[model samples]
Target chain A: MSDGDQMTPSRPVRLATRTVAISVFLLLIAGALVTSTGSGLAVPDWPLSYGKLMPPMVGGILYEHGHRMIAATVATMVGLQILVLGFRRTDRTTFRLGLAAFGAILAQAVLGGLTVLFLLPPAISSAHAGLAQIVFALTATIALRTSLFWSRFTDAAPRAAVEHGLRTRASRLALWAAGATYVQILLGAIVRHTGAGLAIPDWPLSFGKVVPTGAEWATDGVLAHFLHRTFAWAVAALVVAAALALRKLDAIPGLRRLSTLWLGLVALQVALGATSVWTGKAVWATSAHLAVGGLLWIAGVLAAVLLARAATLSPAPAAAEVGEPQEAAA
Target chain B: MRTDFRSDASKSMKTFPASRPLWGALVPLAFLIAACSPNAPEAPKAPAGPAGKLGTAVVAGRVTLEGAPPLNTRVTMATDPFCNGQHPGETELPEVAVGPDGGLENVLLRVTEGVSGVYAAPAEAKTLDQKGCAYSPRVLAIMTGQPLEIVSSDATIHNVHAAAKENRAFNLGMPAPGTRYTRTFEKPEIVPFRCDVHPWMRAFVAVLPHPFFAVTAADGRFEIRDLPAGTYTVEAWHEKLPRQTFTLTLADGETATHDVAFPSVPSA
Candidate 1:
């Protein structure tokens, strides 16, 4: 093996890594389309569409069957990626992550089946959604680590302390931000697939009253909806906080710019959500809201992964320098 | 007190036309009463059309099948008049079933109002035939206060039950094929029909106060006719779907047609 090849990957494998990442983003969009079209239950009975491999794609079958088709495609891509990573590449961490992504995809497919068989019980559906986001983030991380930009970050100067350093604070803040954003997305999925979007009606405030009106509390459906809206507020706050932390890290120009974009998307997402409610969940508005939410999630995960990797690599240059002498002795 | 009572009775006798032959005097008495009223001063004028040509309002539509058997179902349209008690004509069509290729027979039908301004068809008149242990048409539209006739043509007995939220619950046992009973829906609702005997047998009935509705045929076509020229909200409701509403304007001597297609169900 070549000296650089032993540490880094070959160009083809790196290219494959990028392809998988792009595919992950595509899969997220596909999932969003399924949700936007209200095709979650299109295939009424799961693991089969009307008890056949190819059922008529009319009505519910179109959405449900389409979801299955997309899922199967994603699964196949993940399998291929795993095989390529294991046999064709020597990077242990990337290979392991690929395996983890594959495992998650399988579990997600099972959860999806359970959701359909049980008539899309809310919890399973939310998990299916959440896992997809996680898998998406994982795929993205793998791609980021293999990119040329990541190599440039390797030689960047290390910062001092967690309180004052750009790398430390941004990394710490972004990890929390990613976690909160994911949970918020899961809550949104629950809100949507559970028919809770219209439960609260008035956006920013629910039922012409805030903190929930007692009279409507008796209806569980409405309560679920109210909770979803409230969680949206929490998500907004977290995004703003994440943006402020990014501003605090003045040294990392790329991350600061990325966080700004992330926050702007979040703001737009909040507006779209409001318009969706105001418009009485018009199909178009709801679909746009869903689409924007997916974008925000992707952005948040991207920001987190970049910052986290930056932190891990903060000590890498010094260690590499210390190890250079050992290589000379050898 | 006796004298006062006698005087009042004598006055009433003089005013009332009871002494003459009862039938003979009644016509004159009715005429005098009509003359005294200003609103009916001209008497009850008959409409200017042949009695049989009494303007017919039609609710015609097609029923299509998505899954399961091609349904041969019964669809009914009737009205419970709120303003006037008199409705001239009541009509019904035979059980119309869907074909294997998801085609439907035209259920062109009408209904007249019942006494007390409530519209109804006889239980024997309104029937949904279960020919091969399947609801002939998976959907039905009938007027409120009319009985839904569920008939079993199969050899085995079928227990018919309707899960209705706004109407009284009906659970009936059909003893055998050719045995039938009629159950009335006193209230308006969209009730889902089910046969407990055949778990897969499912149908829907929408009991409306006015007979201004029709189900779309397999070809996704529907026509509502003879509506008084005005603006009204026409709603399309499917048992398993959300209700879709459209506003329609009908001019006098004009028939308006409305079409509705349900968004396909999602694939599992």
Candidate 2:
């Protein structure tokens, strides 16, 4: 290993990063619960519940307040992460990512407050939900960058000139997949918050046909639902292509395993999405759909991070020697 | 190695300078835990017992039609096969029901004004049943604070949605037969309830603050007994006709008969 390659994060920093990531994941689930239960207006106040530090936990109030508490805990975890990064990490990119996450969380909190203060206007509520996925992706990225596997992999140089083009192509593919998945997530948020989940009223077809009958396209609900479904198909195609590209690259087995896992998650997410519509947005199905959507997004982000890290390592003769045996075995 | 990593992280968290950043995170969290640790206070109890005097005065009335009643449209339950199968024959919508004697059924009669007293809601729940993809007793009247139990008798799923202007709106799904749900309205208003799953199924609920409300029977007869006598404006509302009002002054123990007639219009 080169002297510069040895600069992986200490175990403490990596663990802290994972903690923040997990906290953000839990926060996402809690937020999804609030949306699923339609409890956004339970407390009817923000920053402070019912004009006090704590509000009565009853009915919808419990879900809404519980979501706030989870969000507050995540914010604190991220804040601690930032503090730790400032003191211990010298990597400018990681530090900046931490700062960006903190800013995203603060903005998310304000958006959440406004969503309640304004009685959950669809635009603000959708934005709040969308921003949560973005923040989760951010934290997930930080976790990936600080993991022991990432440190070990990035420290090792690439071995084959033959692997260079494949790695770059796979990284670009993963990035596209991640970007498309995020757009799909945002579209889904719009569909959900705007009460358009059941607009199409049928799965695998729109209104029992490939295209809805006349004037249906003009309706906002139908349009949003159609576009979300269409985008999901596109995202699925992109993810599948990325997974195939990553499989051909000579990289760490962990990255290969994660690529396969991403494929599986995307498949499960599609089933969940279908069930969400088929059941007319049953609370359990819809909530699970959302949770799986978040997980799919994290998987995509992790894949992109790993591929991007692979793209940076210098080519080495050992990698070329190792690639021949793997190619022959395949 | 993973265990060592966790312990090392905890050690770092402990040994990290007890400075502004560490305190900034911990203090608010500590305060949050402390503030939210207490269980939520119990909801305030409702007022005890009726706040009105008992009297023997009764408002007896019949709702008669002055013109031809609007034709009731036959409801099509094509959305759900179960609902459709339940009614092999045509089921007429109960928007307006007129008796052979020009007496109106399903007309809601209530004391609209001038009689003021706190009347405690009955502990018994008024049931609104969803059967054969239709709301039974299409027009219902209940005291404002009385619970309305909604039960579905259909094998198919039915979503009960109450769209009330003056009360909290609730939308619930009953996915199976015998599924029961209850809700209460705190304000006096005419709430339109519908089953979204069966778009044609609809009902209306007249929530009054007092018990001086009744729906006209099949024979167009209605009676509201036990009224503390005073000048009261009684209003009769029919779903398809303009409302009719009658003003009457009653003395203690006096039974007043005020018959109302609604001039029906063309079907909507």
The model with the greatest TM-score is 2
Instruction: Return the lDDT, model 1, position B261.
Output: 39
Model 2 CAPRI rating: incorrect
Write model 2 residue lDDT over B1-268, tens digit each, in one string.
0101011113343222223442344444333432432111122225455586657888897888888777778865553567778876578877788889988898999988876658788889899998877899799999878888888787766656676767766555454577776678878899998754455678999988888888999989999888887888989988778888888988899998888888877774
Q: DockQ, in order, for the candidates?
A: 0.01, 0.03
Chain B TM for prediction 1: 0.56
What share of the reference contacts is kept in model 1?
0.00
Clashes of 1: 28
Judged by DockQ, which candidate is best?
A: 2
Model 1, A1-330: lDDT tens digits are 121323555587788888887776666666665666555544433344433456544433455566677777677777788787777754677777888988888777767766644445578888888888888877877776666666655445244223335555666666676777777787788887777777877867777777776678886578667766777777878778777887766465366677788888888988988998899787677777766777677777777776765566454345355455565454
Off by over 4 Å in 2: A1-6, A160-162, A218-220, A315-330, B1-268
- Give the Å error, residue B111, model 1: 24
Listing every candidate in turn, what is its Cα RMSD in Å to the true structure after a full C-alpha superposition? 25.2, 15.2
